[model samples]
Target: MSAFVHPDEIRSRFSAALSAMYRAEVPQYGELLALVSEVNSRVLKADPTGAERLAAAGELARLSEERHGAIRVGTADELATIARAFAVMGMAPVSYYNLAPAGVPVHSTAFRPVEPAALARNPFRVFCSLLRLELIEDEALRAEAAAALARRDIFTPCARTLIETAETAGGLDEDQADRFVSELLETFRWHAQATVSAQTYERLVAAHRLIADVVSFKGPHINHLTPRTLDIDAAQAAMPERGITPKETIEGPPARACPILLRQTSFKALEEAIAFPSGDAVVAGVHTARFGEIEQRGCALTPTGRALYDTALATRDFAALPDDWTALRRNGLAWFRYRATPQGLAARAETADLEDLIALGHVVAEPITYEDFLPVSAAGIFQSNLGAEARGTAYAVDPAKADFEQALGRLVLDEMALYQAEQDASVAATLKALGLTTATA
Candidate 1:
């Protein structure tokens, strides 16, 4: 057997390739990346301490390279194949998100690197959504959409071959991995020709714009590729200056000194030309979907803290959730990664008083970066792109997470458990390094 390429390297290469493709397909996305780069540089230059802290935590490098894209599939096979494709690249599905409550007829999950090392290497993520055909009110349109979706195979034969090769053989060699990236890239490539006729397309659009998008295309082209920014507020403001029009409101929690969770803003999706089948002739029309997005990430909150955040989000009163990092840690509202300071290692402190140690410069606690999405925020972005018609609950939705997972061929991993485990491991390692016992520290 040939030597296998590491999944992280494969993922990094794939991310770079995907970014290049998106830039060429959507020129504005390239502009968005440059704008994010500018804002991040400006923020880092103004805050040297923050820059140094980011560098120490191994975040500075990844911040610029990090990019997440979104894609929606029409069938269970497409979703399951996408899951397998990502698995070969060391990514796993995490946190099922029900968007029906937000009026979008889809449940979703984020496919991302699960481990800390792989994440630090390249935290590439894809917000994969599966269209809920049952939510389509028009029975005839729903049946047509399902039949059209069933007829299409999103993955290429080569991609399928490589996925199976990777599974049975344990991993792919360098040549296979390179080929895998290219073959997988084909699955996300944009096609302007619609599979359905103009009349069918009109019906699907009338039913819901998203259904048309998922069913009319040759493949589930990535809708948006988002880059991380140190300052999303600045990025949002700078969009217009860069000849981009951003959404009216940013998604997720509002701006804060110590940013919590994720705050995202995006330019409105572009309305591009599409060609639909019209008997012997092709009919030309317009379709809107792809866009560029930027995000600012902060600490992961504990369940208790998340509840407070939910309340604040519901009531539009953010003050109820304290903005101070220390207060958040003291109140057990957030997860933090602990490290023993040089001074603490020299002293070999026996005390497990984390607060006292922090005050004495013996220990440092850094917030664990949130690695999941907020369901409401995800829906807001999707809804904004699809327009008001997307918010119609005229079609009954059960929000069957189990059905979605059954289609996925596996259960989605719980993001909260992953974050908790990371924090627990960090604390144990930090305490051991400092020669102290963990007594509720």
Candidate 2:
């Protein structure tokens, strides 16, 4: 039997290749990366404890490597094919995001590693959104978009074969994994030539810019690739100085001393020249879609905490909430992973009460970085990039997660449950490592 390459290794290699490809395709993205690196370095230097904390938590290694990309697919077949492709890289679809509620005609899910250890190794994710053709008001335009989507095969022939091989063989060897990454990369590469004619493209654009992006493209070219930043505010402030045009406002919570959930900001989408097929010649046109996004992630909140967060965010102010980590934990506004401290390891304590351990300086609790995206924030990014006209339109239809899942061909794993499980497991492991038991009888 051939030795199978670990999915984590395959994922890491694929992420590196994808980042390189994106940087080449979008030069501004390369600049954005440099700016983020500078900001992260400054943050680590200014707060040495932050560096130590990340290192101790096993996150330091992956900090510079972390990234998540977003793609929009036009059909259920494409969504299912992509899901199978992602599975070979150890990524599973988690959480359903209905962008229709925010006036974007798509529902989405993020494909990412679920295991804590897998995340620590390399937390690469892809936010996959399926274009909702039903939301299009023009039946003729919708039909045209559907017909256009039906004619294209997003996956390369080799990619499809490799996906099946991996499923049958249980895994791919190193050679096969390398080939798989290359095959998959082709599907995401940007095509300067549109598959649809200029007339068809204009019709799709009239329905929605995103609709055109999905139906007129050769494949789902990655619209944006996001790099994780330790200080999003600094990154935002630095964009203009670096010759990058940032969005008017950052998405998600206002600047908090202890950031909650995920905060994202991005440079304005670029207008790129493209060629649309005409009767016998190519028609020149400009397309605006790809952009560079930066994000700072904080703790994943519990359902109760998320409710409070939603309420607070709705008010458009974060000042009412406590800014300290301890206070936030006490108020049940965040989730954290616990670990035994030096003091805890030295002392023989038989207490599983998390608060008691923290109070006694036996266990140190760190916020489990939110490994997810917020739907509103995502829609905000989409609307901002799509322009004001797109923002003005509303999709009044109720969100249909069931329909989205059916299209995806599988139900998304609950993101909250994944976070809760990681937190619980960390607590259990910490107790075992410290040779301690819970306070409960």
Query: 1-441 in candidate 2: lDDT tens per residue?
Result: 779999999999999999999999999999999999999999999999989988998878889999999999999999999999999999999999989978799999999999989999999999999999998888888888888889899889999999999999999998999999999999999998998988888888888888889989889999999998999988999999989999988899878778788999999999999998887888999998999999998878889888877888898665657789998778777788888899999898867777888889998888888999999999999998988788878788887889888988899999999988887888888898788655421
Give per-residue CA lDDT, model 1, range 1-441, as digits (tens). Answer: 799999999999999999999999999999999998888999999999999999878889799899999999988889999999999999999999988877877889999999989999999999999999888878988899988987889898999999999999999999999999999999898999999998899898887888889999899999999999998888998899999999998999988988899999899999999998888999899999899999889999999999999999989999889999899999999999888889989996857888888888988989999988998898888888988667664445566889999999999999989999988888888788887766476
CA error at residue 125 for candidate 2, angstroms = 0.6
Q: Candidate 2 has which clashing residue pairs, if any? A: 352-438, 352-439
Any runs in candidate 2 off by more than 4 Å, and if so which? none
List ranges where model 1 is wrong by over 4 Å: 392-396
Candidates in order, TM-scores: namely 0.98, 0.97
Which structure among the candidates has the greatest lDDT? Answer: 1
The TM-score measured for candidate 1 stands at: 0.98
Distance from true location, Cα of 118 in model 1, Å: 0.9
lDDT for model 1, please.
0.91
